[model samples]
Structure formats: C-alpha cells, structure tokens
Target chain A: MSEKIKFTIDGKECYAEPGQTILEAALDNGVYIPSLCYLKDVIPAGSCRICNVKVAGRFMTACTTPVAMGMEVENDIPELNELRVSIIEMLFVSGNHFCPACEKSGNCELQALAYKYTMMVPRYPYLFPEKKPDSGNKKLFIDRNRCILCKRCIRAVKDEQGRSLFAFKNRGNELAISLDHELAENISDELAEEAMEICPVGSILKKEKGFQQPIGHRKFDKQAIGSDIKSVIK
Target chain B: MSKPVVATTSLAGCFGCHMSLLDIDERILDLIELVEFNKSPIDDIKVFTKQCDIGLIEGGCCNSENVEVLRAFRKQCKILVSLGECAIMGGLPALRNGIPIKECIDEAYLNGPTVSENTEKILPNDDELPMLLDKVYPCHEVVKIDYYLPGCPPRADLIWNALIALVTGDEMELPYEVVKFD
Candidate 1:
C-alpha cells in the first residue's frame, strides 16, 4: 500500500496517498472543495481556479497542489468562498449564460456552483460577447455563448486512438472550444452523452435529448453542489 | 404604524415574474394585509401616490422608457429589488446585446423576413415612441438595486420569503431548492 500523508483541512484531520492532490485528498476524506476543471482520474488542469485554497498564507489551486504531511489547508472559509464567488460572477458576466433558455440548466456544474454560492446578481457588467452555436454535428452541439472555457470537454473527451475530440481553436480573446468534425462524426452516442456530461456549463449538449428531467427532479435541484461530501463527512 | 408601501413595474419583461408573484397563491391575501400597493399593475395605480418602502422591478432597461421608469422607482422607493433573470441580467432581451442596434432595428422594421407590409420602408421614430437603447442593461446598471432574486421568473416561494423577510426586518432564508437560475 502507498504511504499515507496526514494533513489538516479547515482544522479537520485528513489523510491521503502521497501522490494525491489536496482536492483529491479532501474529497477522499469527505470534505467538499468546490471545483470546476479538475475531473476525477483526469490530469488536473487548474484552469478555472475555482478550487483555490489558502495554504500557509499563500493561495494555491487545490487540484494542482499535491498533498503533503503537516500541510495546513484552509478549505471552507469566508475569504476563500468570497474569492470563489467572485470568480463565478466573472464567468457569468463574461459569457452569455442565459440559464432559462439553456438545455443544461439544472445539470450544469457552473449553474449549480452559482446556485451554491447564491449568486443573486453578478457584480461585473455583462459582456454579452457575440458567439454562435454549432449544431452541425449529428449527435451534439456546442453553444459558444454559454462556454466558460473550463476545458473539461477538451481534456476528457477522446477517441479510440487517444486523440482529443474537442480542441481549443483561435487565440486569446477569440479563443473557442471546437470539435474535430471528422472525429465528431463517428462519435458514439455514449461518448456524445459523456461530452455533454463533462462540460461545466451548457456549452456542449446532446441533440434530441433536452429537458428530459423535470424541474425539482434534476441534479442540484434539492441539494447544493458538494452537499453530498458534507453529508458524507457528517 | 401604517403598512409598508410597495410598488412594482415591468420594464422590458414578459410579466412572467408578476405571474410568479401571483403564484404566491392565496398567500397574496397575507401580502395585501402586510403591505399596501402604491404604484403597481395589481392596484391599477398609474402613478406613485406616496413614497414606497419597497420597489419590485421585473425586467431590465431595454429602452429610454424603461430607464425613465426605473429612475423614478429608485427615487420613490427606499429599497429596490430586481425580480427574476430579466431584472438581474437582462435575460432573453439581452440576447440582442451582442448585435448592433442598427442591425436589430433594420431586421425588425425593414429587412426581416417576417416584415411583409413595409412597402414604404418607414421605421417607427415618432417622439411618442420610446427610443431603444443600444443594448439591454440590467436593473443594477441603471440604478442601485438593493436585492436580486434570480430565476426565469423567480419562484413564488422565493418572492414570498424575500418580501416577508424585507417587511419583518429578518434575515432571509435562501433554501437551495428555491434559488434556481431557471
């Protein structure tokens, strides 16, 4: 068995394997750390910066920082939460995230995080950037207006040869997540569904399957995001 | 003491938020008892008779008229609450924000396929008509918005809880189930 490293998160004693990151360790110990980019088993991108935690006076991305013995991490605190909320607000304003018209309303991780943070109104002014939705693919569509650029779909959705189906097209300010048309055409139904599931926002949606889940019955409908971990810890 | 006076308006919205307010069901009776309507569609009060304690604004500013009414509400009310997505983020009408105002006007009046009867190609620019803004703006952008309830049309329970909390001067309880974006 791998050696376990002991750490303290928000004053709670926690243990994790030597190779695990702080976020993984916290979740393993049933501690909830709100994250958007870091998917389980996938390499940590730390792009979203939503899972930032204070470690010994310096802020660190929990998903990128590895667990260490005697490490003191502040997970759930007012300061960190406020910072996270601000990031969420920035994402909301920068994107044209009209949740009422979005198909991934209740299931979207970004929307769920906004709900968890109780984001009544974003502080920043809305950009309302001009973006077009691509519905050319048979099974899936990419709505650029709602994309938060978390890069989860780009990082996770892959073909049989380990080639990425989704990739970033264009440079900064004009950056957009684009699907490889050739690869997308042959994408299986299951993969298409997974792509939709991996997206943090309502960017990637599976065609012909929307609003299938009724209100009050979808994910994050009854409980706030990461509540399961809190319940488990209790 | 006299009841708290309340006013409400729908600027660039579908009045769905008002429908949600009525969704408070028979509890609207409790609301009527708790507060008196000043300037609202419910009371048919065309103008504010007295200063209001609370102003529930349902929609964002999409035109000069919306801005004017919003400013008037801000002047008349002590607290202003942005009700629903439209009031908070400009919602569906804001979808036009990315496009140029000229293009939008042209599409609607002169060039759109739906326009079948514009042989003279005249645009509505009368002084009586409210001129559209370059883009839709959230309520907070125009004036100080004290509170915001975000939903397509904010849930009935959310509206009720907010009003009750505001009137009673108690901390608002935001249950996870009630605070949804859609």
Candidate 2:
C-alpha cells in the first residue's frame, strides 16, 4: 500500500494520496468543501471559485490543487466564506435569476448557496443581459438567461460516441452554453434529466418537469448544500 | 412607542407578497396589536397620513409613478425594507430589461399576436398616465432600502420573523427551510 500524505485542513488532521486534489482528499476525510462545476468522474474544471481555500496565506481552488504533505489549508474561515458569498452574489446579479419564476428554485445549487450564505440581497448592480432560451429539444430546454457558464453539463454529459452534449458557444460578453444536436436524435430521458441535474442553475431544465416536489421536501430546503457530507462526518 | 408604525406598497408587482403577508394567518391579530398600518393596501390607505417606522415595499420600479411613490416611501419611512424578489432584483418584469424599450412597447402595443383591436396603434401617453421606464429597477437602485427579504414572495414565516424582530428588537432566526427564494 502507498504511504498516505498527511495534511491539515483548518487544523484538522487529514490524509491524502499523492495525486489527490484538496477537494477529493477532503471528501475522503469526511470534510465538505463546497463546489460547483466539479462533478464526480469528470475532469475538474476549477471554473467556479466556490471551492476556494486559503493555502500558505494565498488563495487556491480546492478542486484543482493537489494536496501537499504538511500543507496547512484554511477551508471554512469567515474571510474565505465572505469571498464565497460575494461570488454567489456576483452570479446572481450577472444573470436574470428570477428565483420566484424558476422551475428549479427550490433545488438549484446556486440558490441553495445563496441561502447558505444568508445573502439577503446582492450588493452588485444587476446586469440583466438579454439571452434566449432553446426549447426545440423534446425533453429539455436550455435557458441561457440563467446560465452562469460553469460548464458542468459540458464536462459531464456525453453521447455514446463520447461527445459532449453541451458546449460553450461565442466569445466574451456573449459566451453561452448550447446543447448539441444530441437532442435532435434519440436523446434518452435519463440524459435529459442528467443535463438538468448537472447544471448548478436552472439553465438546463427538463421541459414540463418543474416544481414537482413540494416546498419543504425540495433538496437543500431543510439543510444546507454540503450538510449531507457534514452530517456523515459528525 | 406608538406601535412601530408600518406602511407597505406594491409597485410593478402581482400583490403576491402582500398576500403572503396576510398568510401570516392568526398572527395577523398579534401583528396588528404590535404595529400600526399606514399608506398600505392592507388598510386601503391611499396616502401617508404620517411618517412610518417601517416600510415594506413590494416590486421594482417599472414606471415614473413607481419611482415617485418609492421616493415618497423613502422620505416618509425610517426603515425601508424590500419585501420580495421583485423589490430585490426586478423579478420577472425585468425580463424585458435586456430588450430595447421601443421593441418592448411596440411588441406590447403594435405587434403582439393578440393585439388585434388597435388598427390605429394608440399608445397611452396622457399626462395623467405614468411614463414607462427604460427598465425595471430594484428598490435599492432607486432609494436606500434598509433590508431585503427574498422569495417570489418571501416565505410567510420569514416575513413574520422579520417583523417580530423589528418590533421586539430581537435577533431574527433564519431557519434554512423558511429562507427560500421561491
């Protein structure tokens, strides 16, 4: 068996394999490092900065940084958490996040994070950028208005040929996520559901499948985003 | 303490937030005993009779009249609270924010699918009519909003807790389940 690398996260003793990223090792050690855009089995995108942790007095993404032996990392300090909250607020203002009208309001990760942070209102000015929705697909609709461009769907959802079902189109100021012609062919209900589930926001939605769960029963309603992991740890 | 005078208004909103306030149920009796209403649809008071301690504003500013009323609320109330998603972030009406103002008006009046009655294409522009703003603006964008309770209509319990805290000077308990955006 390979020797485990020892590390300290918020002064708690944690162990990791040589190649394990901070986030992976944290999970292994029953610690919850909040994240978006980092899905299981998919290559880490490190795009969403929600998993940012201070390492050696500097900030680094837990999802991408490999754990180093004897490295001290700060995970849930107030300073780092405030930064995370600001990012959540930025995401809110930069999109048309009409949570009241959203189908994914109760279950959305972005909205859950905002709740976790107790963000009463975003400090930044609302951008209100115009974008269109594509409902041409039978099972799904891709609403770019709410897309944060986290690339979670582009990274995770794939076809039988190993092609990404979602892709980033256009450039800066006009960057958006688009669904592949994978929808044109026989797209499975499972795949449509997966795309919608993979999205951190309500951008990817299974058409006609909204508000199915009651208010109190929805995910993250009674608990926080990473509460399940924390509960297991406790 | 004169029962912590309270006021409320609905601008470009659907009045759902006001209905949620009423959803406080039997607590409405306790709330009325604790605070006084002024310039609110709840009491059918069209004008502010006096300065208020708390002002709960629902909806964003979609027209010149909304701006004027919001300014009046700010000037007359000591603590102004944005009471819902519409007041907090312009809500659904703000969907038109990215679209051109002319395009929006033209579509609503001259070119929409169900607008068959107007061959003359008359747009309401009387002096008494409020002029449409270029885009819907959140309460804080127009005036100083002291607090913001988010939701389509923030959960009734959330509203209750906030009011109780304001009236009793106690710390508000934001239970995760009640603090929803929907």
Candidate 3:
C-alpha cells in the first residue's frame, strides 16, 4: 500500500494514493470532472486541458497534477469553468466538428462538455478552413480541422502497437498529427478492430462500424486500456 | 513582366495548415512558376493591399484581429480559398460553443495552476471583434468562397488540384476521399 494523501475536492475531504491525480481521486470518490482527452490505463496527457480545477490558490489540470497532502482543490470554480470553455473553443476551430450530424454526438466528450458548460451559442465566427474530406481509409477519417493534436492517437500508435507510424508535425496552431504510410500498414483490416478499440476519438475507427450502433446504444464498461491497445505490440 | 500575386494568411489556428502546404515537397518549384506568394507565413510579408489571384486563408476567425485579417483577404483577392478545417469549419477552437466568452478567457489566464497574470488583457473592442457565429460554419457560410479543398488541412492532391483549378479556371469538385459533414 502506498502513502495516502488527503485533499478537499468540491468541499469534500477524500484520501487518495500518492501517484494518483486529482481527477483520479475525485472520480474514485464519485465526483465527476469533465474530460475529453483523458482515458484510463494509458498515461495521462493533459493536452486538451478540459479537466481543469482550482488547486490551493491556482487553477490546474486535474489529470496531470499529482495528489498532494492537505491540498484544498476547487473542482468547479468560475475561472476553471472558463478554461474548459476556452479549450473546447480551441478544439472546435481546429477541426470540422458538427455534433448533431456526427456519429459520436450523444457520447462525444466535446458535446457533453458543451452541454455541461452551457455553451449554447458559438461566440466566434465559423472559420471553415479548406480541408480534404475523409481520406481513402474508410475505417476511420482524419478531419484535420477537428484534431487538437492531443497526440493520444500518436501515443496509441507508439504505446499500444510498438510501431511509430504517427508523428507530430509542425508547430503552433498549425501543428497536426500525421501517419507515415498512406494507410497505416500496422493497422491492417484484422488489427483495425483493435485499433478502434484503442483510439479515444473518431480519428481511428472500423470502416464497417459506422452508423451501425447508434452512439446511445453502445455500452461503456469503463475500464482501463491496458491489454486492448497493446494487443498489436507483439 | 506579370507574376500573379498569391497571398497566404493565418488566423485563429495552430499554423498546421501552412505546414501541410510544405508537404508538397519537390513540386513547390512548379507551383512558384504559376503564382508568387504575396503574404505567406513562410515569408516575412505580412500586410498586402495588392489584388491577389488566389488568397489561401488558414485558421478560423477566433479573435477580433483574426476577423480583420480574414475580411482584408476577402476584399483583396480575386478568389478566396479556405485552407483547412479551422478556416472551413471553425476548427477545434470553435469548441468554446455554449460556454461564455468570459469563461473561456478565464480558463486560459487565471484558473489553471500555471497562471500568468499577463494572460489577462482587456477584452478587445466588442464592436471591433467579429460577432461569434451561432455555431462553427464552413467557409461558404461567411464569405463568398470560390473554391473549397476539404481536409483537416486538405491532402496534397486536393491542395494541388485547387491551385490547378485557380490557375486554369475550372470548377471546384469535391474529391472522392473528402467527407462532407455539412
């Protein structure tokens, strides 16, 4: 048993393990912190910055910040609320994300967060960047506009598959996530089932799986991604 | 004595769209022969008033500054092209939907543990700032878009085809691989 630390989240004092994040502690205690780029089992990459909370006196990402003793955390501060909204805005402009028409509408973290935050109207003009529609790979489509380049897919390629097919390209708002081969060779038709299982977003999915299961009909068991993504490693 | 002026501008985006343009690799020389870059991110040229044959606009209009740049390009160019998902669909940053603009700014500057006081700045002149569209929109919604090459950043072939179409004056056709979300 590791050392236990106590922290106050949303006015509730709870005990958490040493290495766990504030998000883990809160979720463990039945408190929900809305997150998009976070998936259990895989190492936490706080790129999306959606799971923000006020720690002690400052706002911090709940997913990346480790637990500390006697820390007073405010999970839903006005400022933290604002950050979540901004991060979502950034995600919206970076991709062609239309939820009502998307397959992942009901289950989409982006849409769920919008509903939670009450982002009823878009505060910015639609950019409509010139983008190429779904590329030839039918199993999944890469909408450059919708990708925040969280690198989770790139991380999935490296951590789960043991192959570095995806690379983070360029810098600033222009940065994009890309795969080396035209079609991800390692992600063969057989392995695609597993790839879809590992990918966190609509970026990589099975071609045959589209519009088959209404997002509402899908069952979310909610477990770690330990063996699922790494099935291709060997 | 006639080098067609081509302009490029980046708006509220990560600049990934311009990088995708470089994916052209060796064929860039052939492209330069047809048109010269007037206000590209690759070059230092920022301000442009001359009429450009093609205006390649990247990034979504997120801030007042971004909207000004967009309108400027639209006014000067003979053909306005939306270059990536950001320019076309408001990109990922448009996710700020439903959340208040004040709240969005709060998250970036104050609430997070990495707070920097400098992140706090007076909101731009509300009148100057382009009003937020009801939702993220494709390029055709805001301005008269002459050609649209869809992609997060459109693939190389689609981009090249767009250039070819502009120079040759052909109709813009949706490529086979392009997925239409609208």
User: What local distance difference test score does each model get?
Assistant: 0.93, 0.90, 0.65
Q: What share of the true interface contacts does each candidate keep?
A: 0.85, 0.87, 0.05
Model 1 lDDT per residue over A175-197, tens place: 99998999889789999999999
Q: Give the TM-score of candidate 3.
A: 0.51
In the order shown, the candidates' Cα RMSDs to the true structure are 1.5, 1.6, 20.8
What's the C-alpha lDDT at position B137 in model 2?
Answer: 99
Residue B83 in candidate 2 has what lDDT?
92
lDDT of 2 by residue, A90-193 (tens): 99998889887888887889999998989999999998888888987888888988899998998888877888888899999999988876543578888888
TM-score to true structure, per model: 0.97, 0.96, 0.51
Give me the displacement of residue A87 in model 1, in angstroms: 0.7
Please estimate how well model 3 matches the true structure, expressed as its whole-model Cα lDDT.
0.65
Residues A114-206, candidate 3, lDDT per residue (tens digit)?
545534334454454444434556455555644556666766654243776567777875677665655474456665665554554455556
User: Top model by lDDT, which number?
Assistant: 1
- Consecutive 10-residue window with the lowest summed lDDT within model 2 chain A: A225-234
Ordered list by TM-score, greatest first: 1, 2, 3
How would you encode candidate 1's per-residue C-alpha lDDT over B1-182 as one tens digit per residue?
Answer: 99999999999999999999999999999999999999999889999999999999999999999999999999999999999999999999998999999999999999999999999999997999999999999999999999999998899999999999999999998988889889
Runs of candidate 2 with Cα error greater than 4 angstroms are A182-184, A231-234
Q: Candidate 2: give the TM-score of chain A.
A: 0.96
